[model samples]
Target: MNNPAPASPSPASEYGARARAWDWRRALAPTGNVGDAVFRAALFGCALLLLLIVVAMFVEIGSNARLSISRFGLPFLAGREWNPVRGEFGALPFVYGTVVSSLLALALAVPVSLGIAVFLVEQAPRALARLLAFLVELLAAIPSVVYGLWGIFVLAPFLREHVEPPLQKALGWLPFFQGTVTGIGLLTGGVILAIMVTPIVTAVVRDVLAAVPVSQREAALALGATKWETTRVVLANGAPGIAGAIILGLGRAVGETMAVTMVIGNRPEISASLFQPSYTIASVIANEFTEATGDLYLSALVELGLVLFLVTFVVNGAARLLVWSVTRGTSGVARA
Candidate 1:
């Protein structure tokens, strides 16, 4: 029967073929349009938020400038004088203090936080892990003002009495530790910042480590790896995430105001010694913004705010790129 005429190319098969070949352009056009609309909406929202922050910062500063921002121009950033009454404003010392203190905070906080996160996630029992996580989160939720107050009264005094003096005595040869123990200084501020950022890094790194697959750990163990070895490999694999978390903590430290202002001593001078008092961008803004008067003075302050915002944005963007690269590289290596 000629194989039943090839089953007459069954209608169901034809229908299926037709469905697959249907006007995809027409069918997907609406969906594509909807997706585009959503993307545009998100983009617009982000732009709006950025615009709002920028405008607010400018407005706040413009309202306080002693002279027009254009009048002082580039000198505003390089000029050392900051006399508002004289309509003079310079950001050099503040910038110096800001960057140095934040870097110090990162140096102190990152490793400690990583260690804490690794221990909590890999070594601690579930009960202990949960407890630790809760505590860290609680620390994070504490207001910045409270931390500042505590830093000034409790931490600064302790550092002045114990930590700063000992370090200065031991590392007196180093410029950073050359000065005599001052309770409120760059070192003290850095220490407080480290403490403030520790919980952030720990929480982030813990989550990152926990996200690692159980099977990967099992495979490492099956291959006769020690616990530390497995953790090292797994953590190394998650290095990008850990770095991003540290960067995030750094950003937080850099932008912190109240706590830092309280402990930083808010000195408007740059010094080689961490033991000497210093100021930061946030502290400068917090301490001076309210008191700033005159167009040029106010503009200079606004310009400082702009610099801080840009610096933060750049750092965060770089961190995201680093994380992205790490994730992409790891996935490719994993597949290979």
Candidate 2:
């Protein structure tokens, strides 16, 4: 009844079981390490490429602007005259227009964008939030030329007929609102720029608000806070991020060309009146770069481009720093 001595496990079977039990980690670790190294190197290369491109752009702009830099010197920035026929150039008006228009855009865009962000992050149902957010972003995808054309045909007339009249009537005493209802000026340019950049500001603010932890909102609510109060608390915490968003949008406004050129009336002068025609750095470049006749004129335009590049660089750099600081703070809070 020793039911035929229990068959001993086969050596082959034992070896097969051992093979089945073997760890893939031991087999694939070297390959994974190689892959990781390759991936890291690829990322570094891409970063290097981006940096090189920026450096190349700076070099190209500097080379082209060299004559103007030598002739005009540092005063080119503060000088107000831009007589192309006499070979004299100054950047102040372009600089002023760029600054004023971008600032106006930011002023007009920030409140509305922030409100939209708040609604999307705090009050909206998921489906509605996504839909609205998508639409908002789609607004940004429209070409600047399209916005410019729309501004010329639609917005400019609308302002002339409806909006600017009231502004002129009510605020005419103010230096900014005193001019005729021409509908194509710094004010109109600002409005177009605002519309163009609002989506960017909104999207950034929405993302910043979303990053606010659920617990922060819950704590705000737990403290007998109203919904608006909770939102305010969250917004206060994210203020630096919002500033960065606005500044980033300002940078976008500063760089806009076609829309501003088409609707800004292309007059290169510093005027307090919002209704007066003005020229921005980008607008000048877009409008006159091809027609630039003399070496100095071309160089001046290139120098204007250089100035614009610097301004955008500074604004965007500051924005990045602000956003970085906010992100670091938020991450620290999350870890804590």
Candidate 3:
């Protein structure tokens, strides 16, 4: 029994095999044209340039700070005294102030930002949302100097006269509320930072919440969830993005200089009370850079800048990762 002649490949199979082979060939091939090669090279160059700039900044600052780093070593981080006269320096107080003020700003801003974002994304009418969003964005564009001026002239007095008095009267037993209510201190600086940070957090959170699939809201409502419950579901789904937004805002508050410098009283001392004056790394650098008379003093200031740079870089990197994760997750859900 002679075997029948093998059947010819079907058209669909032939086409599929050709497509697969083409794909493999394309994958294995070198650059197909000069344009493609040039584009790839340009993109790589841009990325390399950015990396080089960051490395250069780090090296320059480190070299400038070498004297202080050599003299103080690890103790410089925890040293409490920052006496330029005696060539003594410590970063602890500045670090403490930065942490406390930034935390206070986050505390005051996060709730307000969340509320505004939720309302704009879910509850407000289109026209109203547009108007409110524009106003919120406008706040971010206002110069830091302008905010500093407002903090000095308006917010500080208001707090000293009204808010701080009530806070002290109600919570005076707490060390945080026991100091004299100075118009310029950590509290004032925090409030100014809160005002600056709220706009950014709100904008980012509003976008993140809006990006949640509409199907999610519909499903929750289909299950007999109330409006607030539906909103809560959306918020839960977008939690990562919200966290990223908050971290981004914290980074902003951390690097803030002019506004904080103007109102933070510029005192390099650690204190338990928010009403007491304090200094942040940025504030101290701005106040003393030009006035640094000794080499050690200048080197110490450069070291402080390096610290700020590292902190900001790390915070921003974490924020970017969180934001990217949420964005990718949301896209996957939408596609599904």
Best by lDDT: 3
Q: Please say which candidate is ahead in lDDT: 1 or 3.
A: 3
Give the per-residue lDDT of model 1 (tens digit) for 227-303: 99999988987888778777878778888888889988887897999888888888888888787765455567767
Better of 1 and 2 by TM-score: 2
Which digits, one per residue and each the tens of the lDDT, describe model 3 over residues 1-336? 267646543556555665564543223323334565567667778999999999999999999999999999988989999899987899999999999999999999999999999999999999999999889989999999999998899999998998999999999999998878888899999999999999999988887888888999999999999999999999999899889889999999999999999899989899999999999999999999999998999999999999999999999888867766666545422110
Off by over 4 Å in 3: 1-32, 35-40, 329-336
Q: Give the lDDT ranking, best first.
A: 3, 2, 1
lDDT of each: 0.77, 0.86, 0.88
The TM-score measured for candidate 1 stands at 0.77
Ranking by TM-score: 3, 2, 1
Measured by TM-score, how close is model 3 to the native structure?
0.87
Model 3: how far residue 8 lies from native, Å: 31
Q: State in Å the error of residue 180, model 3.
A: 1.8
- The whole-model C-alpha lDDT of candidate 1 against the native structure comes to 0.77
The pairs that clash in candidate 3 are none
For model 2, give the 10-residue run with minimal summed lDDT: 327-336
TM-score of each: 0.77, 0.85, 0.87
